[model samples]
Target chain A: MSSITSAKANVLVVGSGGVGTMAAFALEKGGKASVTAVLRSNFAAVQQSGFDIKSLDHGDIQAWRPSAIRNSVPNTATDATAQPYDFIVVTTKNIADIAPSVAEIIAPAVSPGHTAIALVQNGLNIERPLIAAFPSNPIISGVSFIGATEEKPGTIRHDDHDVLLVGAFANPNIAPQASAAAAKIFSDMYGSCPGIDVIYEPDVRFTRWRKLLYNASFNSVATILRMDTSRMRISEHVIDDLIRPVMLEIRATAAAAGVELPMELVDRMITVDTFEAFFKPSMCQDIEKGNYIEFENIVGEPLREAERLGVHTPALKVIYGLLKGLQWQRMEAKGLVKIPLVSEPGMKYGSKPRVVT
Target chain B: MSSITSAKANVLVVGSGGVGTMAAFALEKGGKASVTAVLRSNFAAVQQSGFDIKSLDHGDIQAWRPSAIRNSVPNTATDATAQPYDFIVVTTKNIADIAPSVAEIIAPAVSPGHTAIALVQNGLNIERPLIAAFPSNPIISGVSFIGATEEKPGTIRHDDHDVLLVGAFANPNIAPQASAAAAKIFSDMYGSCPGIDVIYEPDVRFTRWRKLLYNASFNSVATILRMDTSRMRISEHVIDDLIRPVMLEIRATAAAAGVELPMELVDRMITVDTFEAFFKPSMCQDIEKGNYIEFENIVGEPLREAERLGVHTPALKVIYGLLKGLQWQRMEAKGLVKIPLVSEPGMKYGSKPRVVT
Candidate 1:
């Protein structure tokens, strides 16, 4: 057995879905880290079969296994072999579920002085919860431009884009150099992997808002309409009337939050080459499968931020209401919440109740 | 041979679906009018079996047949027996279908000086087309507050209420007495029918705007979400966020059109009885069945009018865009329209196009 070495990094990836698995592969490919992934469901199959990534950039990866795979966060009190990881990568869809919070999911593997948390998820205002939960640990915010889906169990079909933008959280309490150093380490690890390009951003908030320019518009609209980006991008009316307006609202909201997203970003979002590649956004996929959407983190938080900033975002407000209503409807259908009754009384014609028995 | 008498009024009901059949039955029930109906697709079934109205107020009418039922308007030039009718009731859904316009549908049966047009539809700005078509004919605008559905062919399930508000169009060219006389005659004929109450309003524009308060809000929201009024009315958040804002925009638009719809009407629309009766608006039903919606008359006209009048209606604009996008998407799916390609070129990463074959 090899002794523990300070040069090699130990990484723990939580929520081994498509993005999680991709991160794991990228980390292991760097050859400087031992990666472990924690999966919720399909743990047995993934542990036994490993991962299959059919990438448009890289050739098909038949069965790429990580150093270790576990179903849940190892109980540090029970497992003697478990050790604190230097980096914890999170990649779950930010929906409200019975699973543990991001903080709780990484608690067992985090060491205060050494561990850094990387969030590879969609939407805005997501870093707040992590920041609130862990004040001292370095936080890295990652926005992925890859299109991936896990239609088949234990396999990921990655589309043409596999780019990631990562930046350290601008926390006044934490040293900037320390956070930047941690982010660079992650970027180097992820960038060394084939077919993956990781860029270091100085301002993660700006990057997040830039990514939200697409997510806030295309993701929600596609999910709501049950259509793909190809279908949506085909209509000039949709781009001009629906998508552009939503992007403008997000831009305005970001401006209120002290970030000025360039207008060219909107143009780039609508005119992107891969827009007609028949990519169904992850939110749309979740909705198609009757699964819960990451509505709160993606739409709700941004809308709330807009409201708090006293900026009127009519398009975002409308989208949020629609998505919230749909989420509530799903919950009601599943007996998770009680359907509220109509508050008004029955009709009365000429002072007599119009009742039919 | 029957004697030609002015005492026997001649009426033609076009598009004999649920609303059209109900009007035919009510007109025939008055015993003062000889009613003829124009059936479109179900001409054979309706002409052979007649209509079946299952009502909560009046007992079920097993088979109610009009005096004459024809598949199309009779060729007045060829058939000497055909006579111009005194009234033509237009009840087909006001969608932008590939079929003939409403004016053209009733043209073969309309007499320029004598036949008054009754529009029993759910929308705003519908009378403009009729006015443009017939410059001198008296136009009667009617709003029906009845719940009816055609669950089976040739049958209408009428709910507890069957109330109609009718008035002469506020046309400057037409004499008020002439339009009022025709409207009064139609109202008396309809009111005489048991279980149906018809009210004659002098201010027809006010009535229309009042009815639109409910239609523009509940109808559009229901169609956009593919949800019924019962489900929508249950959530106060939906009302506060979506429904009420839409109504307020409609109210503002009406104000810009020199009509002030009272806020109390907005309250009544939300709090009215029978709102929670699982009543799916006609637009919602149209969407579920993959049929075209009355977007122009219901949403587009109002939005355009608001723009013309220089009033801001942001919520309505967003909703209109979404509905229009969905409409175009449906058309594309049905091969009615071509899907446009993405206009931008592929991405270039560091002086090389990122191409994957």
Candidate 2:
């Protein structure tokens, strides 16, 4: 671990999509941190032409580049050449992949005691695995209220809200001093960045649950219905019958898990006018692009937790089943999984007796 | 009412689509009944060319005509010219419509004590309103295990099994002798007909409950998923998690309503080799055509009954909500209902402060 405490910190941003790119830009704009972004598919284009962000808050930023861009995760041997990162920011959708998990991917770059890992993904109970994997490294959980989309490989359009909530992962085993210091350092760096508001929360679970009120309600609904937020709002049946019931169930589930999310959060989530009218949530966008939905991280994990706590979440379970069906279809379309012939009902009964008296 | 029993019985079949046409054909082939069919949009074609049925069992019936064909419902004044129908067969999908209901449509032709109303539509409690409207007329409930589709306006494709179960509606106020005679007479006519088997069921409610085992489980799920039965069968998750639970709830609801649906029925519905593998249920077919779903008749009526009977049907309720959402969307598409702009999340915020610290 690095003993020298430098004024200028090193930050490595992994999975630089819409959210990751924004974080990379913010970190660079903050000037306190030098940022390096790991790109997967568009590494060459982004490296040569830089990242382009057409944002509502920041306006148009053409060809914005970070300090360095690498295509893949750096191994421990390659990591020995550079200074250990003070903060490793992960902004990938928490969908399971063929590659290693986020914790394993960032392991080589994360400094043991000094570097804090900030998870900026949407969903609940995301920090547990990271904490389990790296007990010494401080884990920072974040909930972002940003309406952004990657229009192309190297271009992003930030359409609406740009507020982020960052907090130290509340682990009783970890020293409070270490977690607080790590959270404070990361929060201060993003707070100073232009075109975004960053709130340092003492309890990250609160923010996670709060953001879940919107994500859990709208994401799968939008994807399943193939409707935008505006269309969903316009249908009273969708809002009152489907969305509100789901949010209520989520609140009850959260409470059962000892989170005690306020009923006002559910009320605000249904009533509050925070999002852009035609804005599609990230999961909906994933469906549009035929990408795998983050079912486990977003809906499955929370549902499993609810089941464990003996909370009744009928609405949530229904939504989960639907989303999983779509996910199964997506996997089949992508040839990730074999499409079974079992669903075909026509082939089921093979020319049986035509007449039965 | 006519006390004389004629050598040839007068029969009127309303809404002769797939199931109705087949029934009309059976009655005509029996030679003891003179059949009249009320055609909707295809009145001219059917009157000119006769009704065409391409059947897997009976093979292609190129042009089989009923004794008479009329487009609109004959008023009581027009009905005065002919003998009142001994059997008024209503075979349309039992979806509640904007126009007058099936009971109201067939009111003019009913001969009270002499005329019997046979409901061959798919659903539960369909005999209720008919019984209320035709107090003196015996109501015969029919459950069809026929796999057929109206390929066009005047054409039907009978794909698989063709078994019809007929039973008297067991109303406490009605004379059991009259209902039994009506049911037996109709069953005898269809039983002697070519290419189909007809069975006389003493308890109609039992048959209704039995059919609900398959319809309640597969119909709405297939519609919501926009998938055929074969594809639905392929997903073990969908069958185990969704279809079975819904059937179980339906059984419970039936039991609460003084009807015991066997667990064996539920098991058979899921595993039975009766259905063609690729066959889409009637509800799913309705969804594909953008026609109004039979939510009230199939899912809503049963769900409301369960609620009234203090029976828990969480799975059915979820399916009801989803089907309602889809129905709402269909209504919006058809301009039958005013499209409200309430669901827009972007408009909800109304230019609120972008940043929240």
- Index of the highest-TM-score prediction: 1
The models' CA-based lDDT, in order, is 0.78, 0.78
Model 2 agreement with the true structure over A100-161: per-residue lDDT tens digits: 67787888776667678898888877788888878778888878877777778899988765
Name the candidate that leads on DockQ.
Answer: 1
TM-score of each prediction: 0.92, 0.90
Segments of candidate 2 deviating more than 4 angstroms = A1-7, A79-83, A96-100, A104-114, A171-173, A229-234, A274-279, A340-357, B1-6, B79-83, B97-100, B107-114, B273-276, B341-357
Supply candidate 2's per-residue lDDT for A351.
Answer: 34
Residues A197-229 of candidate 1: C-alpha lDDT, one tens digit per residue: 789988899888877888889888887888777
Worst 10 residues of 2 chain A by lDDT: A348-357
DockQ list for all candidates: 0.39, 0.28
User: What are the per-residue Cα lDDT tens digits for candidate 2 across B225-332?
Assistant: 776655566666777778888898899989998898767666557755434466677888888988888877788888989999998888888788788878877877
TM-score of 1: 0.92
